[model samples]
Target chain A: MPTIRDIARLAGVSVATVSRIINHSGKVRPETEKKVKQIIQETHYQPNQVARTLYQKRSKMIGIVVPNLNNTFYAQVIDGIQSVLQKNNYSALISFSTSSDGSKYLEAIDNFKNNNVDGIITSAFTPPANWNPTTPLVMYDSADIQDKIVRISSDNSKGGQESVKLIAKNVKKVLVQHWPLSLPTIRERVEAILKELNRQNIAYVLEEVSESDPYLAAQQALNKRNTFDAIITVNDPYAAEIIKEAKRRGVNIPKDFQLVGYDNNILCEYTDPTLSTIDQQPHLIGQTAATRLFKMMAGDTSTNNDIINVIPIKRNSTY
Target chain B: MPTIRDIARLAGVSVATVSRIINHSGKVRPETEKKVKQIIQETHYQPNQVARTLYQKRSKMIGIVVPNLNNTFYAQVIDGIQSVLQKNNYSALISFSTSSDGSKYLEAIDNFKNNNVDGIITSAFTPPANWNPTTPLVMYDSADIQDKIVRISSDNSKGGQESVKLIAKNVKKVLVQHWPLSLPTIRERVEAILKELNRQNIAYVLEEVSESDPYLAAQQALNKRNTFDAIITVNDPYAAEIIKEAKRRGVNIPKDFQLVGYDNNILCEYTDPTLSTIDQQPHLIGQTAATRLFKMMAGDTSTNNDIINVIPIKRNSTY
Candidate 1:
C-alpha cells in the first residue's frame, strides 16, 4: 500500500530523485540509487502502472469485442489474436457482447474509449451513421461493407461457389438450407450460391431455417425425401443434425443423397460420413485484424480492407 | 486527443475544478459546471481511467486466465464469466495460456499484477512453493488441492462413479481410456473409477491414450475389441472419434459395446447414436469462481474451496 512518496521518505531522498531512480531517467548518484532500491525491496513496493500510464500516454492495451465464445470459430480467432498480443507484449481488454446488436457493440466501444485504449478490434456490427469513432478501429466477420473502416472478411462468395462445386457432379436438384439473409455475411454467400447454380443451369430451392434448433430444421429437410438430391446446410452443426435425423429414419448418406456444410469446424471430422465444408481460416482472420490494428495504433492511416481465402474440404459426406 | 488541462484552459477554469466536475466529486457553481461540460463535449474528451484508478485505487478490471479456447468447455466457462462481468460493469483482462505448464501460468500472473488487476481467476496450475500471491486469487478446473486458496472444482469423483454406474448393468469388463495420471483432475477421476469398479467386482483394463490423436486411440481400443463390453473415454470428443472409427470398422455402439465420455460438450448430441457423458457444468464453475473472487476482493478472508455437481447424461451410447 506504500506510495512513491513513502519510498522517498524511507530512503531519505527527494521525491523527484526517487522518481528519477524508478524511471531510470535523470542523473542520480550510485549510492542514492542503491539506498532507494534497497528500501523499495524491503517495502515490497511495486511500481503502479496507472501512474506510469499518466506520463507515458500509452496503456499498451488493445480493446477487443467478440459476439460470443461458445463457438470454436470465435475461440480460434481469439487464440490467434492472443498469440500475436503475447509476442508483442500487449494485453487485451476483451468484451463479449453476447449479442450482434449495434447497441451492445456501441456500449463496449464506449467502455474501451473510457479506458484509454490505443485501438479496438471487434466483430462486424453496423454502426449508426452519425456515431463516428475517434479511436483506431478494425473489424472482422464482416461482408466487406467498405464504410471507411478496415475489415478482414472471409471470401464468402468463393466459399459459396466451392460449396456448390463440391457436390455439383452428383446433384440434379439441390436444397439450400440457410438462416436470415438480413445478416450481410449470409446474404453474400446465398447470393453467390444462387448465381453459381444458375450459371451451371442446375435447379435449386431455398429453404429458410432457424439456427437455434437446427435439429428440427434437419428433420424438415429430410422429410422432403426425394424432392432434392442434395442439401447445402448453413453450417457443420446443421448438417450434422441432418445426418443424425437421416440415421434415425434409416436413410443412407451419399447413397440416397449428398450433404455439404459450411465452416469446417471440429464437427466436420467427427460427424459420421465426415462433413464436406468450407474452411474460412478463422485464425488467419483474427491475426490479420490484430496486425492491422497494431499498424493503426502506430499511426498508420490506410483504411483498405483485406480478405482471406477459403478452402473446400472434401469429406465423405459429399460424392 | 484533448487533455483535461486543455479543457480547463478552454473553459477558463482551474484544472481542479474541471477534475471535480468530471468526477462529480466536489460542489461547483452551476454556471461553472455547465461551461466546463460544454467544452468537454465539444472536445470529445474521455476521462483517462488510468488517472482515475490512481486516485480511486479501483481499476474496475479483473484478470482471467484460461488454459485454451479451442475447446468448447473453456469457451463456455469464459462466457459464463463474461455474463457476470457484464452485469457488474467490469472488464476482463484475459490471458489464454496455450499450455498447462506452470511457467506459462506464472507469466500471466505477473503480467496481471503489473497491470494492477483487482483480482485474478485462473484455471488449475501448480505455483512455485515460495510464490505467495498478494492479490485475491481464485482457481477453477482444479482438483481441490487445498493449497490455502479458494478453488471451484467439479466433482470429478462423482463423475467417475456415475460413468461406471451408467453401464454397470451390461458390462462384465471395461476399457478405461485415459491420459496421464499426473494431472490432478484426471488422477482423481481415475482413482474414483477404480474404487467403484472394485466395489462392483467388475474386471477392467487401463489403456493410456494420446489426447491429440484420439482417432488413433479409438482405433487401438477397437483392435482389442470383444475384450471389454464398455469403454470409458477421457472426454466427449474422444468418444466421438471412437464412434467414427467404430463405424468404419463395422462396430455398433451399445450393441457391440457401451461407451461413456466426460464433459457433455456440444459434440455429444451431434454424434451418431448420440453419446452418454458426464456434464461437469463448466459455466457454473466459472460463475462460482468469479463470484467467489468478487467476494474476496471485497475483503472477505475465508479460503474455503467449493465443488460443483456433475450430471450424468444417458443416450444411445449407453444402455
Candidate 2:
C-alpha cells in the first residue's frame, strides 16, 4: 500500500524525485538515490504493474504455449521454466493449445501482445502469419516454427539410440511402436534405432499405430505379440499400455519380451516394475529457455545451437 | 470493439438500456432487451471483461489450486475442469502448491481473492488458519476439509478395492507400492487391499515407498524379487516406475509378476505392455467441480455430494 508520496516523504524528497529515482528518468544525486531506495525497502513499496505496463508498453510477462497439460512430460518442463522465471521476477501466462486448429496458439500470442508481455516460450504450437510478434521468443522441442531467435531441444536421436540399443543388447529383435509416425521425436528415434538394428544384424519392426483411435494400439499389439522380442515406445503412456495388452495375452516382459519407454515421465517411476525411459531434464530445458530469453532482453547476442542431450534413465524395463 | 453506445444508437435506445441488456441488470423492458441483444449480436460487440470486472467487482474467473504441475494425474483432472470452464466463458488461474510447506496455498487463495475471482476449484491444498473465503468454493479430494457446501471426491475405497481385486486375479501375490503411505489415496487403497487379501486368503505384501524417491523402490524391488508377484501403485507414475525397475532386474512382468496402476492416466497407454489400472475418470471429476462452482456462484443448490466410482481399464499388464 506504500505509495510514491510515502517513499518521497520518508526520503525527505518530492514525489517527483522519488519517481525519478525509481525509473532512473532524471538526474538524482547518488546519496538521494540511496535514500529513496532505502525508503522504498522500508515501506515495502511495490509499484502497480498494470499502471506501469500501460505507460511503458511492456510487462515482465511471458506466454508458455503447450500442446497438452495432461501430459506430465510437458508439465515437468513447465515446472522448470517456472523455477527460473520465478527467480527473475517474470510471470508466465500459460495456454494449452489442444484443438490443433492453431487458433488458441495465435490467441495466446495476440493476448501476450495486447497485455504488453515482454517475451514468449513455445513448445509445439506455431505463431500466426497475420501478426508477427517482435517480442523475444524461445522455442522448445520442435524447430518447425520460424522467427524465434533461440531454440532448445533434448537430443531425441541419442536417447532413441540409447533406448533401443539397450533392448537389442538382450532381445535379438525389437519392435518400435509409435503413433503419428510423422512426429519428430518418434520418427527421428525410429530412424536411429533402425540404423542401429541393421548394423547389429538385430531384427526390428517399425509399427505405425494411429493416435486418433485409442483402441488401435491395443488391437495392434494383440495382432503382433510374437513378431518381436522387445518393444520400445515413443513415450511412457504408450509403453504402459503395450505392457497391459501384452500381459492380457499372457506375455512376460523382459522374458517373453523386453520393453522400454521414453520421457522418464513421473509415470515411469510409479509403473508396475518401473519403466526405464530417457530423461530429457524438462525442468532444465525450461530453465535454459527462460534464461536465454532474459539474456536476449538484456541484449545478449550469443547463439547456442547445441542440442542438449539428457541421459536415458536405465530401469527395470530396459534389460 | 463495438461499444454500448453504438448498440444503443442502432437499437434506438439509451446507452444505459444497452448496458442493462449486456449486464443482465434489472428493470430493462423485454422489447428493449431483445432489440439491444439483436444490435449487440449484429455488431458482434464483445464486452471488455477487465473493465466490466472493475465495475462489477467480479473477475468472472475461477482459482484452480493443484498440488503440482509435475504430476500428470492431477493435470488430466485440471484439463477436464479447464475445458468446461473455458466453454462456459470463464478463465482458469492455476496455482501449484507443491512446496515443502503448505503455506504457499494461502498465497494463491489470497491472490485469487485480490484479483476478485468469482469462485474457486481447489484440489487438496490445506488452507491456512483463520482464512475464510467469501467466494463460492469447490474442493476436490480432501476427506478432511470440513465445509458443507464445497466438496467432491472419487470413491477412493472402491477404487482401492478394484485395483486390489484386479491384482489378485492376475498375480498370485501383490505389492502395494505408493508415495508417502500417508496420502489418503495410498492409505485407503492399502487398507482396502489388506482387507481383500484377508477375506480371499490371497497372499500379498504391502510396501510403502516415498512418493518422492524412486531409487529406494529400485533397491527394494531388487532385494525382494522373490516376494511379490504383482505391484499395485496408488497412481500411474508410481506404477510406471515400478514397471521400469522390474525390467532392470531381468524380471519378466506378468510372467513372474502382474502390475496394476491407478488414475488410468492417459500416460497409462504409453508404457510398454500398457498398464491395467482403475480409471477414476479425472476429466469428469474436474468438469463436475467447475460446473458446481458456477452453479453455486449463480445461487443454485442442485449439485449433490458426488462420490464417483472408478471404472477398470483392462490392458496388457495382466494375464
Candidate 3:
C-alpha cells in the first residue's frame, strides 16, 4: 500500500497539495490534479480515511435523517443530497425515521455526534425544550420557526394560492382533504389556501382524512360528491385514489367536479385525466439544504431560512 | 461529557462489559444492560466512534450501492436494509449509481474500501478482469455467477414463466416489450419466457424499446396492436403508459390486447384496468442480502447463492 507521502514524491508535489486534491477542499490546477490522479490510480494508493479523520478531526461524513423511503418524494430528496455529497467527496450516514417522532431524530443526531460527522441534515421535527445547537444542522420540509437553526422550506403559501386558483375558476363549494394540521408545514399551506379562498369568495370546507389509507380517504371525500363542486386532495397519491374511486362511481372528473393536489408526484402524468398539482421541487430543496450545511461547516455562522419556489402544473383534472 | 470509564464505574461493571454494551457485542444480562444504558443516557456519555474504529479495526458501517432511487423498487429495498441495520446498530453508507455503467460501481467500492466499511451490498455490475475479493460483498438483483461472492437474486426465471402464463391463456401472438437484453438479469428472464412460450406453442416477437422514454415506447408498441393479441411490458410503469396510450387510441385492455408486466409496482393498482405483473419482493431481497452479509462478517465464509421466489399478481389487465 502506497502512502500519501509516496504519492506526493512520485507526483513531485507537496503533501499538502496532495491532501487538498484528495479532500477536495482547496483549489488545485486541473492539469496537476489530473496528473496526480493518474499516478494514484496507477499505484493504487488507497487513502486511510480512519487515520486521516483522527489527525484532521473531521470525519468527512454527513448525517442525514429522512422520514421514510416509501414516498418517492423523500427518495428524490436523498438523490439530490447524494448529488452534492458525491461532488464534495463526502459520504452520508442516513437514518430513516420511519415514523413522525422527534426521538428518532435525537438518537440519529447523537449517533452522528459520536461519530464526529462534519454536519447534519434532517427533515422536519420539533426540537425539545432543552434543545441546544452544538453542531451545524440544516432542516428541510420544515416551517422555519427554530430561533437559531437554519431551515430550507418549500413555498407552501404560493402552492396553496395556486391550488385555489386552479379549482376556484369554476367551483362553488370546495372540499379540502388534509391530514393533521399540527404539522407546521401542513398548517402553513392550509392557512394560505383559506386566505386565498376568502379573497376569491369561494365557499370551502376542510375535511380531515387518514394518511395511512388514501383509498378510504378518497371514498369518504367522494361520498360528499353531490354537495361540493370541487376537491383539493392532500397530495398526488390521494388525488390518484380519488380518480380511481370516481371512475368506479360513474363521476366525470372535470364535469362533475374539479380536482387539485400537492406534490407533483410522478403518478400525476400517468393518471387517466392527468393530475393538476404543485411542483415543490424536492430535489432542489435537498440540494439547497446540503449546500447551506457545507457553508455553515466552513465557519459561516449566519442563521437564516431559505425558501424554494413552487410551480403549479395544470392538466385535464382542472377546468 | 461523561467517559465510558465513568459509566462503567457508576454501573459497577468492568470496562469490557461497558464496551460490549456500547458495541452491541457479546452478551449481557437484560437488567444489567438496561441499567447501564439508562445511566449512560442520563450522564450523556457519547462513545467515540472514530477512536473505537481505530482500536477495533471495525467501522460498524455497511456500504450500499444501488442503481438509482427514481424507481420505488430500489427505495423499498433500502427501507428493508435500514430495518435490519437499525436493529443491529449499524449505519449504511449509500451511493446511488444513477447510470448503468460499471465504472460508478467500481468507484463506490474503492471509496467504501478506503473508509473501511465492514461489508458491502451492491446491485448488479460486471467486475474488472483483475478483481479481487478483499472485502465481504453481497450482490442483489444480479446473476449469481460470481465465484466467491454471495448473491441474492429474485427468481426471474419463475417470474418469466408466470408472465407467460398470465397472458398465454388466450393469446396467439405476443409482443414482448423489453429494454436491452445484454443485461444478464434481463437475459435470464427472457430465456425463461422464450422457453415457456415454446412450451405453450405461443408465437412471440421481441420488441426492443427505449427505457428512457416509456411513453414513446408505449406508442411504438401500440402500433403493433393489430398484429398481437397480448403485450408483456418491461415493468409496471411502462404498462401504465401503455394503458394511457391505449385509452388515447380507443383500445380497451384485455379486449384489444391483454397486458402483463414485471415488477408489481405501486402503479399496478392505480392503473385504469390494473396491471397483472410479477412480484419480485425487492424488500425481502434487500433484507436477505443484508442478513447474509452479516453472517459472512461473523466469520461464516460459506458462499451460497440464494434465490427469492417471485409471485404472479392477478389483476384486471389479463383475462
The candidate maximizing DockQ is 3
lDDT tens readout by residue for model 2, B102-147: 5776666665664456898887655656656667888886543345
lDDT minimum window of 10 residues, candidate 2 chain A: A142-151
lDDT (C-alpha, whole model) for all candidates: 0.89, 0.71, 0.89
Q: Report the lDDT tens digits of candidate 3 across residue range B1-319.
A: 7887899999999988888898888999999999999999999788888778876779889999988888999988888888898888998888888877888898888888877889999998888776765889998998757567688989989988999999987789999987789888888898889999999999999988997998999999888789999998899988999999999999999998999988888888888898999999989988998999899899988878999999999999999
In model 1, which regions exceed 4 Å deviation? A1-46, B1-45
* Error of model 2, residue A132, in angstroms: 1.5
**Model 2 lDDT tens row, A167-274:** 866677777777665565566667777877787888877778776653567568658777878887767777766666666677776677778888776666655556
CAPRI quality of model 3:
medium
Q: What TM-score does prediction 3 earn?
A: 0.91
Once fitted onto the true fold, the runs of candidate 3 whose alpha carbons sit more than 4 angstroms away are A1-44, B1-43
Residues A1-319, candidate 3: write the lDDT tens digits. 8999999999999998888888787899999999899989999988788778876778889999998887989988888888899899898888888778788789888888877789999998998986875888999998857578798999988988999999977689999988899989889999999999999999999988997999999999888899998998899999999999999999999899999988989889888789999999999998999999999999998887999999999999998
Better of 2 and 3 by TM-score: 3
